[model samples]
Target: MSRRGLLRTLGTGAATTLAAACGVPAAYVAPSDRSRSDLSATDKRLTWANWPLYIDTDDEDESRRPTLDAFEKRTGIEVTYTEEINDNDEFFGKVSPSLMNHQETGRDLMVISDWMCARFVRLGWVQEMDRSRQPNVTRYLDPQLRSPAFDPGRGYTVPWQSGITGIAYNRRTVGREIRHVSDLWADDLKGRVTLLSGLDEAFALLMQGNGVDITKWTADDFHTVCEQVEKLVRTDHIRRFTGNDYIKDLSSGDVLACQAYSGDVIQLQADDPDIEFVVPEEGAELWSESLMIPNLARHKANAETLVDYYYEPSVAAELAAWVNYVCPVPAAQDILASAKDEETAALAEDPLIFPDTAMRKRLAIARDITAKERTEFAKRWNAIAGL
Candidate 1:
């Protein structure tokens, strides 16, 4: 789904402030104690919390979700799904009490942006999956997505969908190709460039433009990006920092180029072909809104089965066609190519969704800002972005 809420973004939109809502818990959870009493063996049901408009629906019946229904029918497992996530912080606030208290969230499986997933993983508020039960995920999950710095080997999380943070521009207004991040600062784009207001969504791409290794970026790397942003703010080179509102600015040609999400630009191009998204020559960040089995869930086995079921190439392709984010299962591209509808088949080749080899080489997943780093970083970034 294209999240339109001011705070709703592709990943954890609250990088700096997420931890402030709760002073970092002094207690840590041992791995042996994270699992709750399992009910999957006896109960044929599980609950899933996710964002709205995220799954493939039947064309004539919005009530029916095709892949989800298929999974229920195939496994005799009933999934009671709810679209309860509107804002990342709001959802975190809702669930943190239970996760912090070591109680069940009453949800078996839930999806949250990977940036937030890092917090859950770090605090040991989520349980690791037994990979032997997720063979499809093992076989089809994209290798590029396998080892994010926050969750090495993905022992505790699986990506639900993926996206790229890159540059977007209106070719007609800019009157030149924007091949690198530096182009956003060109004299032609002065006072006509925008950036994402959220700290997490904005920093990695900016750091990448400076040739920093995002996966192992340091305190110095972060401050260097902040210093440049502070200068740009002083010079009026940046018109504003916004959320998805950048879409409106780009569409109106008020801004020639700005940092943008791949999926948002694809939708923009359908209406205005002049809009373009670039994974800069330096690189871009590939991030996900991922799924995690929260602390103590009764349906761990069923949730694991459901997670792996979505990893099946055919199931993943159906979802890719609907939501139009980067698909985490690379093999799904082939399934999309053979889709019955020609347009759907062509989507299989969209470099934004299934980026080709050349583009893949320029993408990296930056390590998430830690709880220790959040306070200082958020203070600096929010001050500069004016959020």
Candidate 2:
């Protein structure tokens, strides 16, 4: 349910196959051809596709989503929410044809990792949102996330939820603190440390540890990390590369340290205080799975309304409490801090939820890996990870 770590396991093999099928065309959609009819005046409904257990569901009813319900009451717009996006690559294969051929993808709006959003943006497969209509989004969205390399000016995408990729370890078992990414390779941790298996998942932190600027990391910087990891793999210094399975290892005390996600580590700490997540002194990646309105969506304005509604601090705080990812609306931190319950109030201060200024200064949104970089980089990375 930690959709934060859900990006990498979307299966590179499936994405590669999809890439072949979706050969980029010479033609592209023009600005004039992007907009469809303004159906918001007549159609009171729109369909949304998202990952499972992503939204906050009613504890008692299990079927109702309170934040979404409130949106309907406020605007009279009905949403047909579907949890159909289990994997990014698989979902791309399903919808790419429709998008590329200028057909309706049967989804008015959707969410996908920022790395993949780069592809859609480059392809002109999605429509730009009207900034004038999204006052809440324009006001409350994190400034750090406003102009990612893919969506400059953020005219196309809005973060659905945000999270950090950093180091997590069982401090009690490790018997020392891990303050830097280099600490994972310390002699005492040999054959007991795990890195993520996916190339996109694993690279940024390693690169950051070496002082490479992830916002504009060069190919030489990438190769430097690869060389170091390859040496570790050969010496058996790394126990193995893994996905979210690292959670079980850290919880069971089978592995003392591993690459981890902030959101997942927060949940783990509730049950096991020994598990600690850290943003290494060097840096960490600030990532978001964003909301994008796909091309030719009939209910474009309606979808924009829903997107902006979530940005209101009170609504964002409600969602953040349930989903437990880093809230995109930093204003929500104050809202959660003033909660009536002590437990809810503590979340406001949790560095993992609302990262402090120090942590914020160290985090960077990595530039999207390009189409040309994908094939060769993945080939080498997968070989080293033995995936």
Candidate 3:
């Protein structure tokens, strides 16, 4: 499924299950019990679970992933890569039973959104990584993403890819530049705008529009945006709420402007020059789908090695050239700029992929909605979104 299609399926039922899992005391694993004897020295293999189409793939042969193939050849650690994670809540439902019962999840490493990573950190479902084994991550990981509120100093998670939740518009169709989140509400855009429907995906950018520091926004800040959205929906100003389908709306000129992911807009711009993505003046949310090691992962040391290897600028550049999200390794910009292929070198200049200094100033990582806030907030946001 497309990333947006997977995200669109995140319904209330899955969210309810996530909220319920938070309160069960047995679900919390103590630090002392989080690791098993490392078999990495002899096992020579590891498994990884991630979302579909998230990594660099050979253009002619989709089954062959270049960077991953190189990793196995260099390190002799055969990787069992599965694109099994479609939705955060759904994946949590699949794995939570074993994690809470103190059993191996049969996977060594997995990538999930940082918001969900926060939940795992709180519940102690993942093991802390040994950074001594990951020096490249220690040096090259982007400074902006280094210290998220949920995993301060990042003891448990390493960002796989980072992106912005910002405004996207068809410059020709909209007939103006969208410089702020509030720009979507202009009279000319009435009935031509769409917002994301999922609560976790939608709220941070809206909160940023109100000039709230999303890193520490309050309940009132959330409700204030809710009220505004309700008004827009009531008046038919918003054409509809959307998932990844917003890409289609913007591309077809059916919708002039909407909330969109930075990475998706990159693909859109490749096909339609008029499509533009903006990190609004008020600010935009910087989020990541991160890699984490689950408790009892037998190949813990090998998994950590794989994580660090990607942090190398050359390998990171190869992956960044294909995926085109914001590269978490800033040094990779230089690598891309010097590539033999001009088209590959041009990726170095795409601000959406490697944000310029000015754009970097306007990005902030939003504090995730807490377990205590999840149930109530999802109920309200889902109602307004008509989910």
Candidate 4:
């Protein structure tokens, strides 16, 4: 099936309502009669689920992650880390059956994007974290990410790493400056740009252009923005909607500009220095791929320890340097600043990594679509895409 079809299929009111009830409708699991592991005492093992290529692995031997290995050696807490998450919805579909049934998901902790995390928080599929055990998180996490609309005060979700949804353009090909979201729809750029296909990825900047405060956006505001997007579509102002494939289009000069994630833009920049990414004048969405403990995990305590371990400045810096995404721990910026390699040291100044105050104001955390809204909007969006 096309990506649009798949998204519409999973984004139904029933699925969203179910998701709101179970914390992750896509990964909903029926409760298993089988008993959970009794690790209330000295449970030494933890099962962590995350996306592929998220963690640093041995350069030659991919089997090992140095930081995780260190944690095991120092604390004797064995981690069963699995990169089972690919697409958010795909992974959700894989695990939803277990969540709905109130059963053990066979994994302890998982990482998912913040927008989806909101749904999980709403459904109560994840457990509230013990803040006492995560003192480093309290100290080092960026103030901006601490109290998102999804989990106020971050009682349940802890951002693993954050990134920006911004504009990326090929300087060598475009031969013009593109500084704002409005610039994307200029006449000359008509067929040379792409927007993110997913609603969560594309909505914030579009809404920001209208000067709406995203944190408190109303349904009328959403529809108003949709009407504007529909106009853009009718005018052929938008070239196409895309997944990560926008990277390829930009590289080939098929697309001169497009909506892009900061992490992916960094990779493109490394390959072709002429590729430039900007967090547009209207502002961009600052998002995270976060960590949460599942409802019936046997190793919740061990999982908490692992989560805290990553929040340490040094550990966060190491991960941030490798992932090339925004680090949630601001203290890590200092650590990166002192790096021996000039390349790594210069990362400390990258606004996308540690957004300065000016950039921070431009960034907003847009609310995730409510269950009814998801069904309503998804239908409209899918119809436009001919899904």
lDDT of each: 0.89, 0.88, 0.91, 0.79
lDDT of 2 by residue, 1-387 (tens): 355446434543654754564454523677777778979989998999987778998999989999999999989999999987766667777888788788888889999888888888888888999878899999999998999998998899999998899999998989989999999999999999999887777899999999988999988998999999999999999999987888878888779999998999999999999899999999999999999999899999999999999999999999999989889999999999999999999999998889999999999999988978877898889889977
- Where does candidate 1 clash, by residue pair? none
Q: In candidate 4, what are the lDDT values of residues 1-387, reduced to their tens digit?
A: 222223334444433443354344344333342235559367788899987778877888889898899999988988888866656666666766776677778888999888778877776678878888889988888898899877889998999988899899987777888887788888888877788777778877778777778788887887887787778788888888877778778888889899888888887788899999888787788888899988888988888888999999999888888878888999999999999999989999987788888888888787788866787777676555544
lDDT of 3 at 342: 99
Q: Which candidate is the best by TM-score?
A: 3
- The alpha-carbon lDDT assigned to residue 54 of candidate 2 equals 80
lDDT of 1 by residue, 37-83 (tens): 88999999999999877888999999999999999999999999998
Candidate 3, 156-239: lDDT as tens digits: 999999999999999998887899998989999999999998888899999988899999999999999999999999999999
Give the Å error, residue 99, model 1.
Answer: 1.1
User: Candidate 2 lDDT (Cα, whole model)?
Assistant: 0.88
Which whole-number lDDT from 0 to 100 does residue 168 have in model 2? 97
Better of 1 and 3 by TM-score: 3
> How many clashes show up in model 2?
0
Task: Return the TM-score for each candidate structure.
Answer: 0.95, 0.95, 0.96, 0.89
Ranking by lDDT: 3, 1, 2, 4
Better lDDT candidate (1, 3): 3
Cα error, residue 378 of model 4, in Å, equals 1.2
**Which residues of candidate 1, in runs, are more than 4 Å off?**
4-20, 24-26
What are the runs in model 3 whose C-alpha is more than 4 Å off?
Answer: 1-26
Clashes of each: 0, 0, 0, 18
